[model samples]
Target: MLVSRQTTVHPVAAPPLQVELADAPPPGVWMNSPQGSAGTIGGVGLRLLQALSAAASIAVMASTGVFPSFSAFSYLIAAASLQCLWSLAPAFVYIYALLVKRSLLNLRAMFIFSVGDWITGTLTLSAACASAGVTIVIDNDRKICAGNLCARFMTAIGMAFISWFALAPSFLFNFVLVVTTFASLLAP
Candidate 1:
């Protein structure tokens, strides 16, 4: 009689859980909805508006050699320049998403957009208000307002305000997206 050896086999366990980093909200969430598409479209449009307004403000402000005389105008030009660049980044991203992804679901990107929008919004608003105040003061002086330069200042301020207005919705949308995405990430 021959002795037989016993054999044992162990089944493989499931792989370790992994987390995926998204640049936007969860796919099944709002980012894929009709409302989400509309929001994305609106955001893209706003970015374009922001860029144009900022560029216009810069051009008008720089057109006058006296722009450097007013600190507020300088700040306005700087802020508008920054806003132009900031808006361009998101604008390109949104355009890419529209063409390829059909939706913007990047949580990280939206968060960034929110922060940038707020920053640019605040800067643009303050710059506009400050420049408007200075322009008003200049207008009151009569002598300072002798030239049409004050008109350019008013135009620049108006454009800055428009840029700020456009930034509002974009910021709001991204803020909601970031909050919801974070909440979703925390869910069990």
Candidate 2:
């Protein structure tokens, strides 16, 4: 005799697994964070302004056709050109950071940025001041500025000043970041 066994299969239902993903940091939080200002929108804007003003200064001075005669004007052109290139490099990096929604301000980067800003800011200020002094002297003398040369020189000086003004904030911000970073490292 053969015996047949019948078996019934039962299905068990398991609870669904829930996964929690971390949300991205908000703009205000990251923008104001001490990580570094170089990656922020405002930082990028300031850099662009500096670059544009510096380039404008170079262009205006070049158009004057008399900058080659004055050592001060030549110095201004060099400084402005340097400032433009420097500002542009950081602006590009900041723009990339913004696109990826990331901050580009590590400790090393902050220190480097601080140093660069200081050097460029000093050079820009010196160039602007020197050019301004020369321009004033030329303006005061009727023989030197008989044409529109003085006016063009004045405009270039103004642009250089604007570039330096924009650089000032960036320098201060980067300096603060470096100081805070070092302080935190040395803290108990």
Lowest summed lDDT window (length 10), candidate 2: 27-36
Q: How close is candidate 1 to the true structure, as a TM-score?
A: 0.78
Best by lDDT: 2
Q: Residue by residue across 69-188, what tens digits does model 2's lDDT show? A: 889999999999999999999999888988987766567887888888889989989999999998888888645786788888989999999999999888888888778778887999
Q: In candidate 2, which residue ranges exceed 4 Å CA deviation?
A: 1-31, 34-36
- Model 1, stretches more than 4 Å misplaced? 1-39, 141-143
Give the number of the best model, judged by TM-score: 2
- TM, every model: 0.78, 0.83
